[model samples]
Every structure is written in C-alpha cells, then in structure tokens.
Target: MNDIENRLKAIDFFCSGGGMSYGMLKAGIDILAGIDIDMSCKDTYEANVKNAQFIHADVFDLREDELERKMNLTKNDNNLVLIGCSPCQFWSIINTDKTKSQKSKSLLIEFSRFVKYFMPGYVVVENVPGVLRCKEESGLSSFISWLTATGYKVHFEVHNVVDYGVPQNRKRFTLIANRVTDINIIPIKQKGEVKKVKDVIGEHNGFPRIEAGHKDKSDFLHTVPRLSDINKKRLKKVSKDGGNRLEFANDPELQLNCFIGKDEAFKDTFGRLWWDKPSPTITTKFFSISNGRFTHPEEDRALSLREGATLQSFPKDYKFIGTNIAAIARMIGNAVPPEYATAIGKAIIKSQKNAI
Candidate 1:
C-alpha cells in the first residue's frame, strides 16, 4: 500500500470539546482538524487535543471545495475518514421548541455533500436515536440511499452508549459507510464489562465529599451548583442514595405543584442516582436536580462538571473551557462519549488490519 493509503486520517464535523477527536487519536488515527461553529468549543478543543487544529466554521455555509483546499484532501482517498456527529437537539426527544432546531435538522444533508464530494474511505455518524426513528425528517433515509447506490457498504443502528463502555445510559444512532470493503463500525466490548456509577465517581473514586455549592479553588470544574433553600430541605428529607420524588407524594409541603396530581409521572426528577447502576442520560441541564436523576449518590448537590465529564468517559485531565455552567454542561452532555469513540476507532483500526 502507498503511504497515503496506509495512513488513516480523520476530520471531525461538529466536534464539540474534541471528544471524538481525542478518542480517535488514542487509537492512533491522525486527526487533521475538528470543525464546529460554536466558538466556545475552540479553546477546549485546542487545549486538550494535540496535533489537531480546530476550525471555526458553520457546516451549512462551508463549501466542499473550501474544506478540500483547506485540508488538502483528494477525491476518493481510501484512507480518509469523515465523521459527522451533528447537533442533535432537533432529533432529540427532549421537550425543546421545534422552531429552534429547524435549521439544524438538515445538517445530515449538508454533511452528505462533503461525503459525495470526497467519497472518503469511511464515513461515521452518531446522533440521538430519534434521528433513526424519524429518518425521513432527519434526512437520514436519503443519505443512506445515496451511500448504498454509490457502491458504499452501509450499516446503521441505534446503540446504547453504555454498551460501548460509556457509564451513562445514552442511546444514539450510529452509521458507518465504507466504499473500500464491507462496512463494520460498531465496536463490541466483552460481556460483564459494563461500568457502574460507583466505578467512576464518589469518594471511593477520588471525588471528595463536598456540600451543596462547594467550589474547589484549585479545580473549579469540580464546583457544584448551589441549591435553593426549598430544594435543600426536600433533598434532606429524601433518602440518601437512589431516592426519588415519589417519597414526597403524601407530603403537601415538599410536593411540587406540577407533580401533585401526576404522582407516577417523571419519577426521575429530583431523584438520586443508584450507586450500582449506570447513570441516567446526562443532559445539558445535569447540574440541576430537577432535570434528571442527576443528584449525587451521597452529596446533596447535583453532579459537578468534573463528575459529569467523568461519567461521559472523558479522561481525568481533559479540560473544558467555558465560564457559564450551563454552557459547559451543554458541551459535556452533547459530546460523543470518548470511550465509545475510542471503541469505534479501534474497530476501524481492526478493520484496516484485517483487510491487509
């Protein structure tokens, strides 16, 4: 094989905080650059990821020719890998406004333009399961049809991120298309290797016990959001570990007005995580107890930024750059779990070795 074909290189689209970039690098894939429009991601992406440049550009406006010129990519490069893990708020099942994601929903179509122009050796996509459920609406069906018709072997499926070694139970749609050989992208871990929350966090895992609103001056990322007086009182009454809001159903004082009549609904809200189980999906609002079962197993506060990042399989020393807690949480929650990405990268490397 020629040097160009022997060397596997990648470019990550919508790479937030360089999760996929860093993970793929761990598997020995050379990352050319990470492209994202969010300027907030630039510092974090550059700070933690070495050898890969961060390109600040909106995919919708970025022309294929410009990308090829900027990256010096050639058409039909068999060693090239193009990954498009676009913003999933539109395809997400979260109760968000439809209007806000109207423009983002068509990102797959935009990404397809690059795939068609470059016809890279491999193409990767990871997003919410809703993208597969609403394939036509999310432009996935069309993209798949095109890939198959163009002689590319394609495989797409919805996978629980926990199955790929992410400590959180996030379900995502993953697709890998290859023009050189049969497509095989999904990574498989050995049975009984699933990780639990206790394995990654808490005092046993080096996270010191801290009260609500405690901020470590040396490591500000370990800071937890402050709890209100009412929330604090309610949390004090709830059980320490794996407690749910249902305990307050009979108590008129602590019961939220929204859940009074609907006692059985939204049980995860204001709930504590189970120590022995994988964590619930970490959302963009994980710092707030009202969001999900985000409360620390023992601590009174919700998961700190560092804790959440750890749960997402980010390395201990990986740094995120953002002042606003909400914005930083969004970056962590939106990321493709680094461990899962590493698995995918390993699978790709295995495929390359097998082909030889």
Candidate 2:
C-alpha cells in the first residue's frame, strides 16, 4: 500500500482528555474519534486533538453497530486501530474503597466486545499491574485467551514509564495484539541519563515558584490546593529538598494524632519529593500535600495542576477543562503519559512497516 493508503485510523475508547489520542497523533496516526462517559473530557479532547470527534457516552450503552455506523468503520479493516484504556481503579494496587470501583471492573470485558465484533488490525490496552495480578477478576485473562484463540498474536508486560522517556516512575500493564503479525512494545533506551524531576520541573524548567493557595500570575491552572493553618505549620517544620515528616517527629504541634505510633507506615504521606530523582506515582489527589509524596521539593505546597499535567507528559499548551482543581487533578492523574503513548504508537508503526 502507498504511504497515504497505509495510514492507520484510531478510535480511542475511554479516551479521557485525549492523552493517548494526542500522542498517537504526534506519531502520525490519524485519530478518528474519542469516546468517553465523562462530558468534561469532551472540550479538552476536541480542542487538543485535531480532526477527532468526541463522543460522550458510556461504554456499556455503546453498541458495536452504533459505533460502526457513527465512525463508518468496516469489518476486518487492516488499518483500523482500537485503543482501550479503561478506568483501572478497581484493579489498582492503591489502598482505596474497592466498592466504589466495582462497576469499573467489567469495563475491560465491555471493551473486548468491540474488539471481537470488529477484529481490528491493532488493539492496545493500558492499565495498572493489579489487572494482571487479578486477571481473572478483571477479565484480562479471558480477553487475552480469546484474542489468541481467534488467531491474534498478543504481547503484554508491565513496564515503567520512566524507561519510555516519561519523567515520572509510573508503572503500567500494556498489551498489544495484532492479527497481521506478532508485535512488541519496545522501551526507548536512553542514550545517557534518564529524565529526573529537576530536569523537567522546578524553577530551572520555567515553572516559577508560587506559594500555597497562590496561583501563578501567568497561568491560572498553576494553583495548588490550600493548606490549613496546621498543615502549613507542619510543612514549614518539614525540611526542604526532599525531607520527610521524621524531621518534625519530636515536635508535638506538627505531629498528627493518627501517625503517633506508626512512624514507618505510610511514610510517603506528607513527604517531599527528591529533586534529583523521578517523581513517585501521581495520583488523583496529587494536588494535596497529604497525598503521597506530592509536595514540591523546595516549595511549601503540593504540585499545581499544571505541574501534575507536566509530570504526566502533557504539553504546556494543552488546556484542561474541569469544574475544580480536584476534578482536573483526577483527569491528569488517570491519563496515560503522552510520551509513552507516542512510543507505543511508533512501535506499532514500525511493526506495520516490517510486516509490509
């Protein structure tokens, strides 16, 4: 096929704010549409992803025939790519109320329905490692088995995003299935030093310092959650440049009632990030210093919305649409790192080229 004819068209399911779609576009993929239940993602997805329509609908309610009709998709199209990055909180290893996410556990199964009906040339799935650990419960095992049974070659493994040029040390389970041939998701080997927090964030990286509850004058989204007076005092006592709560352990006023005896447990909570190292996993509560080691290395407050998005490999110009800081943080934290998605897209293209 000629270059124009060989172009791959992709439709991203659960495409929250167009992270994966943006990266695929960066790698020369033609994104046709993004489907998600959250109406908040529509504006952001439509604005940043050129030539792609945003469909606000629950996956459970979306029928294969409806999707085929809406996107004009044909059965067994060799150049069609279906991307699924369903919400993985149910299978995430994080400590949370599982009951809230119980409904999301079956989303992968829902995604498999489209895969079976269309049998697209390429299929991609990205989720947390817990999905593999509890594959049966998450429907991942059956999905892989069905794909392999039907002549699709499948490859899946858990990989850290830092190895794929993302500045954060986020681990994700990735699966790539193709009917034309066996495919692989290769990590981008760094020539020298990998990216560190200092290299991509802080004053050196153009993110000027803004105090807690203050927004950067130039960017309104560069604002952090307000810390209470006690939390502010606690943060002041906590040393700068990657210090922990242990520094204020002896201080009676700074210590919390819940953490009196459990010094070793939950050490990451209310901790500062190391300047020279890659950041810990960014979560939905990354805007709060009480959540993980989200505090800025030298600053007194937690990361801003813009900083959180930056850690997730989003471009500076990418605008987020949300009602509040927490809502925006959830969108940023749950997104696939765009750089890693770009790498995946490139690998698929390389596989296609080799097959030809």
Candidate 3:
C-alpha cells in the first residue's frame, strides 16, 4: 500500500472482454491477468489489453498454485488485489425467469475461495443490484460474510453509470474491501451531470451504419443493424431528435401490439430517447426493435452494436472479437462500461496510496 508508482497488481476474475482490466490499466495499475470461463473472450481480452495474460477457465475449477505459477507471484507478494464480477443472470431483475436453481451463482463462492487462499491486500466486487437482495443462504451473502469475518473493511453501494458520466443509465452494485486502507469506495460524479445520448453517438462519432450482419472493416465484430421496411417507415414518421412510437402510433396503421388496453401505460416500449438525455440501459437484445426503448430517435432501426457500445462508454478504438450479431451484442451488453470502471480503478489506486 505504498504511494510509490506501480504499487498495485490486479487479477480480474470473470473478466469479459477486458472492460474492467482496460479501465484499471488506464488508471495506472498493473493488470496481471484476466481469468474467465468463456474461451471466446480470449481474443478480445488479449487484443485490447496490454501486458495482461488471459486465462480461459471456470473460476470454480481455478487453482491457486496454477494462478501463482502463471502470474509469477509467490506467497510473499503484497499489495495484490483480486477483482471479481461474477455473472449475475440469476439475480438480474431484467431476467423474466428468476429461478434460484442457476448454477452460476455458485461462482461467487468460488471467487471467495481465491480470496481466502490469497488473502490479497485489496478486494473488489461488481454485480447487478439484485445481488445485494439475494438470500443470506445464497453465495453472494456468504461471500460478504466471509469478507467481514476476515477483518476486511468493506464498502458497497448501488450506483448508476450516468452518475459516473457514462451515456447510459445502468445501475450496478459495487463493493471494495481492503485490509490496508480505510478509503470510501463509492464513486463521485465526475462531471456533475449525465452525458446525453447525442453526446456519444452518430456519424460524427465515426461509427457508420452497416447492414445487420456486416462487420466493421477495422473492428470485425462491431456492426450496425439493417432496418426493416416496416421499421424504416415507422422511423420516417417519427419527428426528428426525440420522437417516439406514440407520435406515429396515433395513426391506426402504425400501432404496436402492446399499445392496446392497459399496455398503453408502458410508454418506454417503442420509445425514442431524447437526444439531450442519457440512454436507457443497454440490454443483450438491444439490437431488436421490439426490445426496450432502443429505437433510434431519428432513424428507422434499433440502436446498432456500435451505438450500444458507445452508449456503454467503450472507446471507439475498442475492438470486439466474434462473429454473428448475438455474439457481439452479448459481449457489448454484458461488459462493465470502461468509463465507470476507470472511476472505480482510480478510487482503488487512491485508497492504496492513502494506505501507505
């Protein structure tokens, strides 16, 4: 916990596409490695990150001896940090099927196994807000209990991405626990106001419109959606900047299936985002017109993969790896926005410095 440069070494667990790793690297930490179960993430994680090793293995199966060998660390290494952001599909509110039977929740306990083994100086966890609401018998609760029992000072909060300057309204539960520092982990709003959708997307942003399956020449997995005839017509009818379904649906021919009866109260469906306002949270099915308020404010199609990434605060230079729209969209949607991650990283660094 020295204030000296390069005092922290971090290992990112469940590192999908290196979003957190990238931000930590930008914040001047040495990201030693990224570990995940998905083999598909290897290329993307390695391509965009610097000097960070990518391991393709389930956290449940990970062995401390193997990780230490790979990371070139021994029992003597101090100022080490372990970061885990386990998959939260089981606890996500957006998931219609809220079954507790999901095996993925077990990964939280797996993450704790590493923490107990390494007893790193600092620990960080990020997950959906639903995680904090999960039952005490659940893995998430047990993980928190384990941290407290180990005498770590833990701070956690549900935070909105917009509060940290991301152009999207994503809420997440973030926790930072440290044995070496007493610093607060909550993020301070960098600019005092959320960034607007228009502040991030469009032709000027350098992401051009591509057909649904067409990949970007430079960044192969980044692609835009092809507008269907019906949606194209619908978008044409919408007024510029912030018009939505209600404006055109007044015409009987343009009414959506959900517009009838009590559904009329749900205006966000088929809604267009105001240009000057932050976008709604980006979801896995964000490219489909019928899902959420993804429709372009002025165009006929849902927001494209590139647009979604931009809204998530990924740099224009960040390249995604994969084929097919689902693969790419899933990667983008599941990622922690880099801008928010950067804020978390900076806080961690500050805490480490203060510990000295």
- lDDT against the true structure, each candidate: 0.87, 0.88, 0.78
Q: Residue by residue across 58-143, what tens digits does model 2's lDDT show?
A: 99999999999999999898888999999998888795889999889999999999999999999999999999999998899999
Sort the candidates on lDDT, descending order.
2, 1, 3
> Candidate 1's residue-wise lDDT over 1-356, tens digit each?
76455878999999989988988888878999999999999999998789888999999899999999999989998889999999988888884788988888999899999999999988999999999999998889999999999998888888888988888888888998887777555665636778999999988888888888887655437878899998998887768789988877678788899997897788999899999999999888999999989998877889999999999999888888887788889999889899888888888878876676
Of the candidates numbered 2 and 3, which has the greater lDDT value? 2
lDDT of 3: 0.78
Q: What TM-score does candidate 1 get on C-alpha atoms?
A: 0.97
TM-scores, each model vs. reference? 0.97, 0.97, 0.91
Candidate 2 weakest lDDT stretch, 10 residues: 183-192
